[model samples]
Target chain A: MNDTFKKLFSPIQAEEALKDRTKEFLAEKTQRYIGVRVGKRKHCLYAAVCACLLLMLLGGRWVYFTPITAISIDINPSIEMGINRFGQVVSVDGFNEEGRELSSTLNVKYKNYTYAIEQILNDNNIAALLSENEIMTITVIGPDGQQSAKILSGVEACMTERGNAYCYFATSEEVAAAHESGLSCGKYRAFLELRLLDPDITPEMVRDMTMREIRELIDSLSDGGQIDTSSFDNRGNGHHGHGGGHGNRRRNGRAEQ
Target chain B: MRSEQETIRAIEQYSDTVRRLCAVHLKNDADTEDIFQTVFLKYVLSSVSFESDEHEKAWLIRVTINACKDLLKNFSRSHTVSLDTIIEQPSRLPEDYRDVWEAVFSLPQKYRDVVYLHYFEDYTAPQISRIIGKNVNTVYTLLNRSKQMLREKLGGGYEYE
Candidate 1:
């Protein structure tokens, strides 16, 4: 019975056409096996490209908004402008009450640093002070890098037309110490000189004093002698001369070198 | 999913055995083709690790039988084969082989799997019990009854034991 049954079933074979059809069905169902792999790879590539673009956008925003140099303008209103790598003023901060009022009136945020300084000098109140010979000081404070030198040069060029304006570069350490005493960079330099002469002056005494008042105090304390201008100009690499003689200020572009 | 090479190799090796199991349970070529697709496609997608060639063959047989039974359970589709197709199938065989084939298929569905696995495939009752998911003693009864039926149909001239 077993031999007979084997012979009976032996003749039954699946035809080539049936096997071929079934293979075609499986191939269709499984996406030819390669399509799935290629699809997954394409998805991964798109995700990678999107991540790269997002990182670049975030990095670009950081680089554009971060300040590399600060320009402190002190006449009576002591205001500081933060300058980015591209020379744009990204921030405006006032060190005194009058400085805050002046900063609020000037629409200089996001403008080029040179343009912002020109705007401040051209402000009606500031222009009136300059005409009256109220000593105005413009200080560039940052690391002693090429960017700082470039900023100082730009500031010097901007101030060449004004006789009493002084443009000096100071180190970040000097400026940080100045901020601790609640003074702008220019006022801080004057305070350091005043401290040497009086040794009893406090930051509060000169906190609201005009730059002209501070300069007059320095000149008086020096006993009509040549005040050592070294303290005023920390980085003496560029533009280091003093506008001497308070009353003899006709056109002593003495600080223009 | 399995790779293409592995699936094709499995198709080439087990397609014949699957067809025979389909023949034992199904009535026509369309149903047989369904069993083939279902069984082989399952093999491709399944991650089962086979111990040997025989293990793979038994797995295919079990899947094919289940596929055939599921197709038959669908009452919406016709369960009967046409007389013409039935006649056409046996006409290709020699007279003695044709008689045996007819006698085997004429048995009930429950007896056909046991008779095919025991007599043709030479599986012991325990192996058939494991493959078909039946009790061993039940498989023994089925094999005995199927042999008696085949002998009665083909006439008591051969040793069916």
Candidate 2:
């Protein structure tokens, strides 16, 4: 039955009909006439301009600033972070902090510590901060209280400022260790790093705050949180608290911190 | 870079594929010709270059499908020829072939596009994915679902040769 159907519906060679039509079309397109060619030229010019304008509009230049922004973060020290115009982050690093790269293991910190980092992440309303390079800015705050942030350009270059403590978010080895060791959240330093980097966040406060408060903070941050420093043109320029000056800068920066 | 003559030759060679694709979609000779001309004109005017004949053919097929879709949209508004009317119109073929074509034409635009690209154009799911700008899994699922629908429409009795 299928064979019969195939034979009947298979493409037939209407070769002569196609060839004759092709010859006619080729002739028409190539034909030259001495009569007023200005109209043709004018039409061509108009089409070219329209095409150029359309290309310009669609050529990634006509930035439509969407209200919702997504940001990606790479937990890999070797990878860079990227922030799109819409504020979505895309990280492209191969490894996380525990020395494991792409392993599927989930690193276990203490329940409270894991809860703390998760709380900050949840409170900030981050879209998704996987160990990928989609994040706009990555703030690596050390266990010793020092902090630094870097914007990743590409997947290869680890572009960081000098003297900054670089820590990948979660390595496979760390994740495996966390899982096997059954370490409590307090044992994980990376989780602590995330807490310190978040200005409104503190470990002790997690015990005090309800889940709703934590969720609300995350929602607010996700919906254009006051903490987004990437939107400011002069981030970390030391321009304190006035409009176009240090005072306004300090106020805005402090608000996020 | 290919010369103008070479591009023209390529178009001439693949004109039949373009015509068949248009014919299958439009089901009207005049409309097919219009789409064919538009597709070729696009090829002539386009500054894009293809790495191989297969690439050029794929681009032409995609453009032809898009042109056919545009014509279908306009036809829906100004003309009253429904797809069912076209499918039911008398053909000289046997019932099974007629039934298959009818089912093909009756498919929704998305499903029909995948089926036509797969069966008529002989494109693999991955190739269809690239041509239609869809994920491989999506193309695979569309093909599987479309084929099942076609089988159901055929009363599930016919087996492929």
- TM-score top scorer: 1
Off by over 4 Å in 1: A1-41, A224-257, B1-161
lDDT of 2 by residue, A35-114 (tens): 12555687899999999999878864435322111112222211222223432332222223321332213222222222
Model 1: how far residue B121 lies from native, Å: 24
| DockQ of candidate 2 against the true complex | 0.11
Highest-lDDT candidate = 1
How do the residues B85-106 of candidate 1 rate in per-residue lDDT, one tens digit apiece? 6666676566778878788778
Given candidate 1, what's the lDDT at residue A128?
Answer: 94
Model 1: per-residue Cα lDDT over A30-68, one tens digit each: 788665567678889999999999989998888888888
* Clashes (N, CA, C under 3 Å) per candidate: 0, 50
lDDT of 2 at A179: 32
Worst 10 residues of 1 chain B by lDDT: B77-86
